[model samples]
Target: AQRVTQPEKLLSVFKGAPVELKCNYSYSGSPELFWYVQYSRQRLQLLLRHISRESIKGFTADLNKGETSFHLKKPFAQEEDSAMYYCALSRSPGGSYIPTFGRGTSLIVHP
Candidate 1:
């Protein structure tokens, strides 16, 4: 079974400060990792995926298979960046991949 953990339930930081949202996973087989964010009164959206190797909104996450981690990082955080972030893990059991999400971490960027 695959599991994703985002140890912190809430992460608070000031504007213009660096931000790092931790995400760790445990899976026996090859796993796919993704970061999703939901703003107030908005639907959840894909922030980034390990496979994409691309940064979104100045945030980037690299898959470290050795550590079984895919932590999201941003050089500097903005007030508008505050949102509910979720870490997800997916693996093919036989057919399609079913994703398991973390409890979620609320990021608060203070000005």
Candidate 2:
């Protein structure tokens, strides 16, 4: 069975601190890993993808096949980036990446 695990339900910290959102998954075949973020009152947008090897808004994620994890990391967290984050995965076909979102980790940035 394919499953996505996000250990933290909520993460809060002051601005300019480093942040790491952990994610682990279980899949038999090749999986497409993605990180989707949603700010307050904003639509969810793709933050990064393992396949793309791209980082957005100071966030980057890497897929570890051995550990079966795709954790998101950022050197510094900004107040503007504080939002709800979800780690997602898709099947090999890549036609319909119906993401199974984790419970979500709400990041609160205090001034």
Candidate 3:
């Protein structure tokens, strides 16, 4: 069975501190991994994708195939970055790709 694990349900950090949200997954074949964030009243938006190799709002995540993990990181945390973050996995259940998200981790950045 394919599964995504997020050990922490909530992470708190002070402004200007570095932060890292851990995510692990088990799956066969190539899987699409993404970090989605919902800020306050805003809709859930894509934060980063393993394939994109791009950083958003100072956040970056690297997909480590050997470790089977995609961990999101930021050099510094901001109060505005506080939000609910979810680690998602996309795999083909048949011909169509299906997205499965972890329970989610709420980040609280204090000034």
Candidate 4:
């Protein structure tokens, strides 16, 4: 079953708190994963990718094959970044782009 899973439906906490959004995936071939975020009515944008090994907006995600996870983490969450986060996986080749999205996690950074 090739799929992307985001376990938590809602994760609300105060600003400057540590945050982690869990993501898991199942794929047959080499897995390409990405994390997308939507900030309060804004369009969804790519946050980070496992292959790129980069962090965006103070967020980072790591791909775990054995555990089939790509969890998003941040040491100190900012109030402005409070938004909906989704874990996604792509099955297509060449890393061209197009990922299956999770239900999404709503992160509330309470000021």
Candidate 5:
């Protein structure tokens, strides 16, 4: 079974401070990892994918296969960056898509 885990339920940071959200997963097959974010009263949106190697809204995450982790990071925090973040894993070796998601981490940025 594939499982995704986010250790922190809530994270608080001051403006201009750095932020890191932890994520880990357990799977037997090759996994596709992604970070999703939802702003206040907004729908969940895809922040970035490990395969893309891209940064979104100043946040970036690299998949550490050795550690079975994908931690999101931002050099500087902003009030606007406050949101709920979720880590997801999905990959169907046999072509059936089954996605597992973490509980989510609520990020609060204080000005």
Candidate 6:
């Protein structure tokens, strides 16, 4: 079984301040990590994937196998960046990939 955990249910930060959204996972086999964001009145979208190793909208997350963590970080957060962030874990077993999402973290960026 695979599980994703977002310890903080809500994160408040001021504009231009650094932001970190903690995410931890537990799985027996190698799994892929992804960060999804849902803005107000908008559908959920992919923010970043561990396999991509790229930054999107100034947010980046590195998969740490040693610690079983994939924490999302941004140097400067913006008001528009506020959204519901979710950590997801996916693994392909028997040729099927099943993804499990964490109880999303609501990011509130104050002006």
Per-prediction CA RMSD (Å): 1.2, 1.5, 1.5, 1.9, 0.9, 1.1
TM-score of each model, paired residue for residue: 0.96, 0.92, 0.94, 0.91, 0.96, 0.96
Candidate 3 residue runs with Cα over 4 Å from true position:
92-95
Which stretches of model 1 miss by more than 4 angstroms? 92-95
lDDT of 3 by residue, 1-111 (tens): 678999899999999999999999999878899999999999999999898899899999999999999999999999999999999999854635778899999999999
Candidate 1's residue-wise lDDT over 23-98, tens digit each?
9999988888999999999999999988899989999999999999999999999999999999999994563798
Supply the global lDDT for candidate 4. 0.87
User: How do the residues 1-111 of candidate 6 rate in per-residue lDDT, one tens digit apiece?
Assistant: 789999999999999999999999999788888999999999999999999999999999999999999999999999999899999999955636888999999999999
Candidate lDDT (C-alpha), each: 0.94, 0.89, 0.93, 0.87, 0.95, 0.95
lDDT, candidate 2, 1-111, per-residue tens: 678999999999888888999999998889988999999999999999899999888899889999999999898888897899999888778456577777889988887
Residue pairs clashing in model 1 are: none
Cα distance off (Å), candidate 3, residue 95: 4.4
Clashing pairs in 4: none
What total of clashing residue pairs does each candidate reach?
0, 0, 0, 0, 0, 0
The superposed Cα distance between candidate 4 and the true structure at residue 31, in angstroms, equals 0.9
Q: List the residue pairs that clash in candidate 2.
A: none
Positional deviation of residue 94's Cα in model 6 after best superposition, in angstroms? 4.6
The better candidate by TM-score, 4 or 6, is 6
Pairwise lDDT winner, candidates 3 and 4: 3
